[model samples]
Target chain A: MKKILLPVLILALVIQLFVPSYMIWQRYDVLKSGTEVKFDIGLFDPYDAFRGRYVSIRVEDAIATSFVRGRYGILEIDENGFAKISRVESEPPKEGLYLISSEENYFSFPHNRYYMEETLAPEAEKVIGASAEAYITVRIKNGKSVISGMYIGDVPIEEYLTE
Target chain B: MRKEKWLLDEIEKWQTEEIISPESAEILKTRYAPKKKINLLIVLFSIIGTLFVGMGVVLVGAHNLWYKLPIAARTAIGFLPLVASQVLVLYVYLKKRDSIAFCEGAAILNMAGVFSSVAIVGQIFHLPSDFTNYILLCGVLALPSMLILNAIAPLGIYFWTVLNGGLCFDSLWETPLSTALYVVGALFAIYNFRAENGRAVYVAWISVISGFILVWVTSLLEDFDVFISLFAYFALLGSASVLWERAGRSLEISGTAGTLIVMLFATYEGWWLSSIKSDITIAVLTLAFLALAIGILIKKQRVVPAALAAFAALLLRAIWALVGLNSEPFSVVFMIVANVILLAVGVYYIWAGARKVSLLYANVGMITVCTLIIMRFFDSEMSLGIRGVVFILLGIGFLGFNSYLVRMRKKAKEEK
Candidate 1:
């Protein structure tokens, strides 16, 4: 048992560790060189006892399209510099960034939650709530994406709340 | 005499009664001791300790105070606790290998560390919090380590996590998930059932199987799940009777008792009347399991639980069919019938337990009857003062009966 277990256990642990390491690497790579875009977001607050608290984010599409999961949606910057999907596509665009809808009634951006300190999340939610316009800066490349910063009006939510 | 139950019982009684000093008892017992007797307390503590570690890591990940650092540094440090935990586990695995408690703790902590490793990355890069995928990752990735390290508690936690996942995520794999977990749990039973003295194995197998049942319970098909549970529990009971007679009684007791309790739930109109968008799948699944349960109960000579299942199935069938015919009469009839069945079951339990001198069953029966009266009181149009008086009287009566039964049992034992 010991003879066979050592190698197999080590391999399993390695694979286990590798997944998160690979996620960090892949996400970092996307953030460093990915095409940057901003999207105005609608938000609410929910407390996840397991994962602290965060703003639950939603986005309105600039151009309405069939809400088909697994289809690619092409990105185009709107008049105010926030992103809007130009159209849904069966394949990735030849020379521009796109994000895939993972759920039927999908939010355009890949990431929805911006996890924060338990005490601070409600404050952020209220800040976003009071603001007339809010957006989040996202770095997107290929089909992978990450939320860089959440904004209240024109100011970064973190900086705004601090001020 | 080495493994004789009477000898072991005598030794235990002698130790407990202070007739022999523990060390002296141990010395005497060594000659007659069985090969292995898994310490249930240690195993139970191991499970709890492991849960604390797992929950601690998750809470700490949620606390996440270091996101302002550069992404690279933040990401690098994420694996720090995970690495440290892995190192500790590896050392325990290779060297200290001291006790089951120590090894089980180390292995389960490592499993939690795997969850933290991934979760911290999500925290680091502000990844979307999709717990379904996240926990599924944790359960699947940590599974091999659980078996390889012989950590049964991790298996419990694994099923528990997926059970929550099924509830939280509402996956397509709900039934399949339970099936798969039961396969492992049954394997654990088969492996450990006939051991010299196996409390820890019994506990582990119960956790795994009950975990499977619980996950299956949290779904849309209410009528089906209730009867299916009977079949599953009794089948488990029957198999335990054959494969491990001593442990089988424990399983049989819970299995039948559990199905009876579930039948009480089936008595509620809400369970059958839920407009849960059913199809042919529900009927087929319910019928199949009900038949299997009836067969097992007859074979095992379990008349009471089998009769309970039979009653529940017929009630379920009649309720669904009558509801289809748009009959309000059966709905009204269901209430009277449910209470009648409830009253009958309660009376049977009381009689069976009293006849057999099994105080636990009799008390359960008494409690069941009391609950029905209390429920009726609440449902009745009686004044608050009147209801309150009834409640106090009922409580006093219950206490009186309980003591009277205890005295009677003691007298019976003294006579014997």
Candidate 2:
């Protein structure tokens, strides 16, 4: 154990020597470069002691929400707030275009980047909270994406339109 | 023969307790009979060392020599007291060889030197009076030396490192980096836990708390609101409960405390319910968690009363949430009544539980139920006189009960 520890300690020391103090670099970079997306904001779970809320976001164009709802078809949303999609389509489209809402849920998240319609009421009801909006930035640089940051205002709509 | 055996046992115990050179101890046991020469020498050297250190302090305090001394000179001068003290100790240790006074003196001098190092460095640098910078500078300056020297002084140094690390987390590292540092610290603590005794327990506790603090800080930087914060805390605690279930009962005790602290913080923040409202899915998930935890308690035949209390409190909040407070909906009253019923049921379980576990669960459950009742009473628009009287009576009752329990515990300990 001592022999094994010696080299590891030396390595840690070596790493420390080389590790320049670049504080908050990752936070700054992620905030700067992360992809911005709009989802439906569902609720805010507020804690009294820690003093924060968990904002749930419902992605308007979620394929899995549809699948869970047993809805057959791709979903498309019109500017008139109308949604339609073809179940005849064998697989989800690759373009990743969808009418998204800014709804947020704490745990339940969409599996794929496809559009969703309001076929699942109970699911949507479970997503409701102290608020009605959810939009967050997703870092999509790799094949993976996660909630990088959340937006407080209607920046999701503004960013979607502008970008 | 028995006396000889006892003497040998005592000698062995003393040998372990005395951390200095074993040869010195054996020599002291044999050759170092009490002599005026050794005492005189120890006192003489100690006085000389004290004078040297005093002079060094005076030199530093004189201010005229401050700027004249280069940084290297200043650093060297700052260490003069330590050097002098060590030399004095070494002389006494070699000459008189009193291990008890030598070790104790070494401990004291080492502590003093650590404080002086921090003070002198801060003074010489003309550093601002900010706490974070002071702690960071102190830790950074002392840590490497402490570890390399194998000084027990690292206990304080590592503590300061972790403390300043948490305070400076937002500014010190990206989220990942912060998390990594915390993990590194925790790993160090775990490494210490394999020691021959519980000597590393402090390190373990510090590491766990510091790691969680870093986690919390990182989450805050991500703008996790109070509700999410509670969820995160509870989630982490629940995870820890499952993962560290076998680490030992001592760790479990502390872990339970940690979980309780999180739940208390959740209740205090009002996030326990808001998080649920923010997302029903999360609410349901938390409920499921509570149910699962409760099941664990029941199945294990050892209720984690803290967990039960937290879930019970959550139940009340859920009911309150179901009936909007502003609306004063029927749901609120119904839920509160139902909660009262649940509390009764929980109390019944406490009474029915096996004697071994009942006390533990009952204390925690009753505390939670009492807190809930108190909160409800305080929140309700009752008459001031009645409220005041009730408050006083409840406070007195709690104090009296706790005092009686404490006395009983003390008596039990004395008997043991």
Candidate 3:
């Protein structure tokens, strides 16, 4: 084994010198799309300079404790803990909520299903962490779904829409 | 009576085999001849020493003389230092092909000088700091050494070239590319197919540092996301497993971390329960993974632990999915039962195997089982303080066990 290790190592090293660079390129495109082109749907970072104030969001909770004045749909927290926004199939499901067919891949925005583990009352603690609250970044790209973002206070959607 | 019979049988067999022929004795004596020349070791060492001195000079010159010399002259002088070293190497190589101290070292050293020179020259000439171009130039120059010197050094240069190419040419290098490349480089570095001790270790270390650089580069590219980062971690872990198996290098830490990262990422992605979404898919994936584990184990491969851990995680994901889909009261009960059974079987096999088979592989299996158990426990609804305490205990346990096992194994080897 010792005899052949040298050549084997060299071969591996050389091969690495030529792997495709496509993965890296694609990652950059994703990063650029996220940071530079700011299209505000709901989610906001207080430090997000362009969007004057912290954007409030409509939390999609299972209990349906509170109401959004004009909600696009309900989102569900997937088992993976990501809150994907999907159309509310039935108004406030009694049992487990059935997700509305958004005709978009769950991985992409404007289609994924998100379930809220807890309710977000207005001016309440938005997150379990130091962040204000958890809200979604809704982009109408390719369809519409919430990109998970920092939490903020619950505000009337009507107020933000008018602004 | 049986022991005495066995001893009598052994004595008879020994007496029969102990008779040595005259021709056999002559052949054995000839094979052990001290007069046999091994001049290759001397030549190899000379070349290696010269290469190291050359590198030292370059480092010194870079600090001192390089600044004083005209940029053009500095560029030209790079060639001179290397050329002088190469001339000496070639002379010895030609004169004493049979004796070499460490051939790979010389090759690596040779390319190190060459690459430094080219990179420096390119810098002086105001050439585009593009990584790919630098790699291309280095690749062309070092190409001969790869073929002729039979050294691993040129490979090091080649790696730098490729890595630089990605950094300069690929915009992704500014983002995930750096992380991705670092992962790729680290995999190459730990790839030892034979003896653990050799000149290749240095190359492997270089690869590791480069990988760290890659990680740093990627950080500059974008903000860290759990999913993408985990994906990268998984890729690194998978490759690291291969390195572990091939080189027998102790990369279990990276491998374990990588696997954990990926699993966490997958859980966050909500793909953990993907198998449960379709029972057939779950069954097929499980079978596939089990098959892989069995295959590895059959071959006594080092990567069996990695495969097993992956299989266990996938199994858990499948169970979680089923529980989600079927809101029956007994769903969780069934899931728990299934995991318990599987864990029991796995532990039994690992323990039994340890007692009967080779300890190295058995130790790996045990470690893997323990890791999975720890991972699952952490995923459960435990308090933060409790979980932290558990994690600390597990870490200490692992360290202690491995340390004790290593000592035992070493002692056994010495006794043998």
- Index of the highest-TM-score prediction: 1
Report lDDT (CA) for all predictions.
0.66, 0.43, 0.43
Predicted candidate 1 versus true structure: per-residue lDDT over B220-309, tens digit per residue: 434343344444444444334433555655655565455456656555555445443333554555456456656665676655543463
On lDDT, who's better, 1 or 3?
A: 1
Among all windows of 10 consecutive residues in model 2 chain B, the one with the lowest summed lDDT is: B267-276
TM-score of chain A of each: 0.86, 0.37, 0.23
Report how large a share of the reference interface contacts model 3 reproduces: 0.00
Shift of residue A100 alpha carbon in model 3, Å: 55
| TM-score result, candidate 2 | 0.41
What clash count does candidate 2 reach?
50
lDDT of 2 at B415: 100
B95: Cα error in model 2, Å? 18
Instruction: Supply candidate 3's per-residue lDDT for B203.
Output: 49
TM-score of each: 0.72, 0.41, 0.40
Q: Which consecutive 10 residues in model 3 chain B have the weakest lDDT in total?
A: B122-131
lDDT of candidate 3 over B348-394, digit per residue (tens): 54665677786754654566466556656666543578658856885
Clashes of each: 0, 50, 33
